[model samples]
Target: MKDLTILCGVEACAIFQNSFPEQPTIWPSVGEANRIIEKFRSLPEFERVKRMINQETFTEQRLKKMEAMLKTQQKDNRHKEFTQVIIQRLDGSSAILPLKTDDDCVELDNVINQFIKDIDRKMEILQNEGSSSNPAPQVS
Candidate 1:
């Protein structure tokens, strides 16, 4: 039995065991097992059978079980619609603003416009200060 178990490592042997569980054979030696495995692998149906075993099982009962599991999970979970406004800056920074109502969108627009105006005003002040300090070398 232990010797037969070792032969299961071969692909053909494993497929044979799965396909015909009732009739199990014990090869006299590993070389004999290898020769038989080679013959089985040479058959056209070997790859097909291997693929069938590896593929997902989609039997009717299995699908019904999966559907029930999904329904149960859905019942336990709370689903909500989320709305967000993403602001991306030139310096590779980002801000996400979540909105719950129409009024929040209107308020967000006003806030963003005011923020741009503030930045422009600060830039103008900086430019004015830079020009005054330099004075363009008197430009006579």
Candidate 2:
């Protein structure tokens, strides 16, 4: 059996998204992405940030770790499902458990923010002229 050491983060997301056809005819719309992010931000798990509007749960340290983890995974469909889970969690879907406590909320919020940053970074890298490697296997 394989291990799933990394928590939900940007690298995991990149792995999943990288599998998309080089030129996807149907990419997620900006509105959808924003909605996903917005929903993630509001999930109960992010209470740390909610506790203090000025505090930064999305710290640089965690972001870097998330980035590192994201880089290790292979592209897969899990990214879409992960995004959907976040969206559902935020959209008042009672079928799932809400972020339990302040710490959980804050931690998740930080991770989600980091995931966004990772995606943006990947986009930037993709836009720039660069060398490439053979893609890895899809995780899911």
Alpha carbon deviation, residue 73, candidate 2 (Å)? 18
What digit string (tens of lDDT, one per residue) describes model 1 on residues 1-140?
A: 44655677643333234465586554445676688677766769967586454225657658889999997775333121111232343335564455667755765666567668988999999999998988776565
Q: Give the worst 10-residue stretch by lDDT in candidate 1.
A: 78-87
Residue clash pairs of candidate 1:
none
lDDT of 2 by residue, 1-140 (tens): 01232443321111124575674332245465566566667768666355343325557657788887776452223444445667787788754534566755665566578678988999989866343454556798
Off by over 4 Å in 2: 1-84, 87-97, 130-140
What are the candidates' C-alpha RMSDs?
Answer: 16.1, 30.9
Clash pairs detected, candidate 2: 11-70, 12-70, 15-75, 16-76, 45-105, 45-106, 46-105, 46-106
Off by over 4 Å in 1: 1-95
Best by lDDT: 1
RMSD of 1: 16.1
Each prediction's Cα lDDT score?
0.59, 0.55
